[model samples]
Target: MPNKIDFGNGSIDFNIETILIKKNNPEVKKLAQFYIQLFQNPNIQIQEVDKLEFTQKNSIILGINERRDAPDRYKIQVTPYGIMVEASQVKGLFHALQSLTQLVKLNPENKAGSIRIPTVIIEDEPRFSYRGMHLDVARHFFSVDVIKQYIDLLALYKFNNFHWHLTDDQGWRIEIKKYPELTNVGATRSNTLIGHYTDRPVKYDNKEVSGYYTQEQIKEVVEYAKDRFINIIPEIEMPGHASAALAAYPYLGCTWGPYKVANTWGVFEDVLCTKDTTLNFMKDVLNEVVDLFPGKYIHIGGDECPKARWKTCINCQRNKRRFNLADEDQLQSYFIKEIEKHLYRKGKKLIGWDEILEGGLAPNATVMSWRGETGGVEAASQNHDVIMTPGSHCYFDHYQSKNPREALAIGGYTPISKVYAYEPIPANLDPKFSKFILGAQANLWTEYIEDEKKLFYMAFPRAIALSEVLWSRKEDKNYAGFLERLQFHLPWLKTQKINLTNAYAELDYTLSKSGDDMVLHFVKAPIKGKVLVEFKHNANNFTQEYPKGDSLILSNSLDLKAWYQLQDNSLCKPIHIIYNKHKAAGASIQFIEKPSPKYFSNENSIINGIAAPTNKYSGPEWLGMEGKNFEAIIDLSKSDTIDQIKFQLYNFPAAWIYPAKEIIVEASTDNLNYEVVGSWKLSPFTQERYIEPIVDLKKNKSYRYLKIKVINHGKIAEGSPGAGHTAWLFLGEITVD
Candidate 1:
């Protein structure tokens, strides 16, 4: 937002017959022509004059004054007569033009050849110097044209950095002159995963997909971004996520002679070996990468590198002994430091994922914290620069809404509201180290996103909110006001043929208990759209109409479906909820063991009278624990007859979430002592993904307190996504009948 925006009474009937520039500068004239196109009126023309005196009454003037407070700061003034934009540099002038584009809107009463401009004086500059957005092209390749369009979208929102993820396990997506095999052999995949990675009977498309950018194409993109003031940071994975590169040259791997580019996603056990030959091979690749990109920093993906292969490889073990390293972790650290030295020698700096902090961090490497903020805080505390892109807030691949009708996305939920609320600086960090926080970025990982339309659906609206979070003052944030401005841009986006998602118009709901009664609450969307809900209960169906911000009482168990009727009268995809009005519907739960922060929802989801779908364990309705047991005591408030206890556990080994090893149900009257009513022990080899363990008592019993204990399977077996790590245990709704 602008530091100051003073709106005056009345509006300007801006008949833009001509755009007057201060001098005949090519760059300035080019910008003038671009803004003219934004007007969408052929009558608008550009004129280069020796002096921009603002002598004309109905002309737009673009001028430069080298006295602004900041390099990117600019001022805009609009009166009933004409409009003037002044800035210190080309970047600032570009920003001024963008603001002017937003200020002018179509004339409602008169449909053509003219526009209405808001009369205001505005002064603005960005809050952070490094406002960035990232895209991963290795998983699913996007063409050079689409890449340019992506940069254009970033420029429209005033972002200054574009992180281009060029290489990963799925495929290497950049051309290296000396290493022809890197493209010829490493750039293609055998097949892609059919659906969610955890889907059992693992399916594949069995078709080839491949792409890579040539040197000329990369130069073209670099120049395009340079014109828009966006610096491109190209990522080349190293030490880990190097399966694609290893497949091209098997000599780079610890177990040489045979390798193939990964056909699926996730961490691969094979990585770049620490031997001198492999190190030199990586340096050779970097030599070409550095020549192609003029940016100061290069990203070496130092994440998700497994030590299993390194532990057994002869060369890696020899290198560890030669360096007197304590373990494989330090060997990985050694590998990163070697690469950092190489980049520094090439006149570039190093940026790596949070795992670079593993054994020890490199002396001058900047950290891109993706797992969470702890790594960022630690790096900042050590006086190293950090870019915070935690998965909770910055992963665009996460589901924007709980609407099941939405496109398939990588699991996790990060809505626009969550992205807008992100604060780059950790509140608990020391003030002295706060300067190391370089800003933040949001990553679009593309594992689930397959094409351009799906990509735009996940990026926009959320990206818009992120722009404000990165550029505007913290005090200037008003989501309501932002939404109002976004409405004006919707038409422009459509004109550009961008397939942006209207998540802002989607209805959202919450489940909770109020005074012993379970209630389903509806929150109003930012846009003024009507919401309709349909209920199916007792073999009868009925539809109820309600405006936004209403609640319904769950007096009976039913299948409830709700959707939004947008302004265009198009209904959004409906969200379904299965309500079970059981004896423990609104019960209070006291947890003996709490869930991990990554999967913690509200404390009441277990007894909120709702159940998540069997296959969808990532929703808030399920609580997940990492290598921990589930022990909770539910207070029913009053004694009720109970004969059966039912609950479900999610078992998806591909994702490392395991079913229960045992389940025990007990009852108590005074909350002090408990007697076991039913118990069951299960094997870890069950094929059922959604395990619904049942415990039935021989006779009905009345008790105010019911205790449930679920034991989790320990570490994951030898060949899973998170092998050798503690398994995640997810529990869904619990019902007492």
Candidate 2:
């Protein structure tokens, strides 16, 4: 009812009673069934006609329209007697059926069954032949059923490409007949790190976790995707991100001594040797991959290959000299060029991460720009095809909120607005480069993401935003209008059992301050019965006690209230609350504190200090780390007065553990550092945590600095044999009143 469906002719009335579908492909039967189920209305009778000669007077023709010579062309029209639908492909027929289903009423007013659609013409064609969504299955393996479901969702959104990142530093996820070890030994992991990344030695339960897709299973998936007109582009990362391959066969690496499928996330030093054996192994693996995927392009991950190992390897040095490469960078370029040539010879094109633009891009290679718009701009300007997926806008692992409690606690923040507002074409790029630019993609690197529900929660709304950006012109995208559409789709999403977190619900916060009295309020929708609220004088430094007293508890289906007094110009008590509810809830707070002096300092110095971390100081104040379990103690016992605390965290690694748990900041007046001041959980992926404690600080007292204690509720295993589970947390500036 939202919009009227129209064919290119005059408004017509017709009744569809019989459906005749004939095709040699078995998938066509599935398509036919899909259409039948979609349009199963009691008012319209559907009959499957096997032959053209058996068509009834009022039958609809549903088969390939070979005369048109268009694979996806479809025509839906109204005749004097009935509705006629024709297509050149089963997918096209299915699409037409979806359109028809959209036109009919759920419950018709009359059994006579008369439906009318407006006279509208739509000769729709894709802007880019490759509209893709890449999933890092290597970091964490999803079941075959989940993959199929993901495909179905992509098909629903009209996405045509699925770039399956099947191998990486953490694990290998596909079976190769020539190298059975790729799956048998490479697919499994010894242990995954449970906490954020840090120098601290952390440990997990140390259990083995692994999965792989068999050749037969891969074929089934490929066929399933083909029926939906979606091509599966499998990425077999080469030369680098080949820790798993090195682990499976050590001789493949430049070191040729020791390595394992990385248990933790992040780029490792181990890389594929440019030696003959390594190249041959890669060629054999690619040969097997090409047989499985019919997509014109094969992605060879060329991102994040560190030069540390290459610098020291004899074989790498030999390859560098053999290829007339000047340095390691040129060596990498030469290596990629060789692979590109191989793929080209095999009747396929090669695609790589934006890094392929480093030395000199391959002639016909495409680039997936992930670091930022610069790579994409560079690639397109050089007349190379590019797909813009900068981490700022398209990375789904960052925190989506300003509150520390709502983020994934690993990566930087990438709010819904940022994702929705992303323009595939950068403003600075040459206009000519725009033509070379294909559509964009939102990548879900599942290093920390564990389940499908969480994946759906993070993808939707954002995915919807991406879809509109890809399908509609940029000028047509209105934030408010998109929100309205999102509201409507929420119901459908619910029906599909998708767990989507509405960003609007998390933005409710109110603050008020009076003479010695201050108030703060927040609203939230929790799926569980209880949620925790922690109050801290200094959010940067705090600690948590396991069972109780760490946070306050708010109970019942009622508003929470707390009262406190100021002593020595500081709030006598900082209240923390935790509660459980059946549905979503909201919170409010009031406190008393004496006003302190306000002075304007150098904002640049503050910004610079807070934004970047070095050896002398930890990175940005907003930076939050998770990976290894460690206690961060912020000493607030010496400060005169505190106003705000900002944290900067390293970007979450491309793995499933980064999105697994909530990162919290606890505060303590003493170095022993105790009590929860502020807390944040991971919300998909956007990184940045800001906490402004409403409590008053003791003036002219010994309360100086604050401490931060980071806790990881056992999520991911360790990264390597000796490597501890870790996450990076950077600290910037602590603004005080």
Each prediction's Cα lDDT score? Answer: 0.86, 0.62
RMSD in angstroms between candidate 1 and the native structure over all alpha carbons: 3.1
Measured over all alpha carbons after superposition, the RMSD of each candidate to the real structure, in angstroms, is: 3.1, 12.7
TM-score of 1: 0.91
lDDT, candidate 2, at 490: 61
Index of the highest-lDDT prediction: 1
What total of clashing residue pairs does each candidate reach? Answer: 0, 107
Error of 1 at 378 (Å): 1.8
Best by TM-score: 1
lDDT of 2 by residue, 1-737 (tens): 11223445565555556656564656656666555554554444445455643345555566565655565556666555455676676666665665455345322332234556544433333344456777888877889998888887787666778889899988899999888888888999998876555423565547787999999999999998887778888999987899888888988987675787788877787888777788888888999999889889899989888888888889889888887888888888888888888899899999999988888888999999998899889988888989888988888766565443453535666767777788888899989779888878888888777677777777776777776677555556676677655665665667678877555324233323222222334433221112233234334533332233223232332233222221112221222232222111111111111111121122222222122332212212233333343333332223334433443333334322232244454444554555555555545545423222222333343344344333443444476222344533323333333
Taking all chains together, each candidate's TM-score versus the true structure is 0.91, 0.67
* lDDT (C-alpha) at residue 494 in model 1: 74
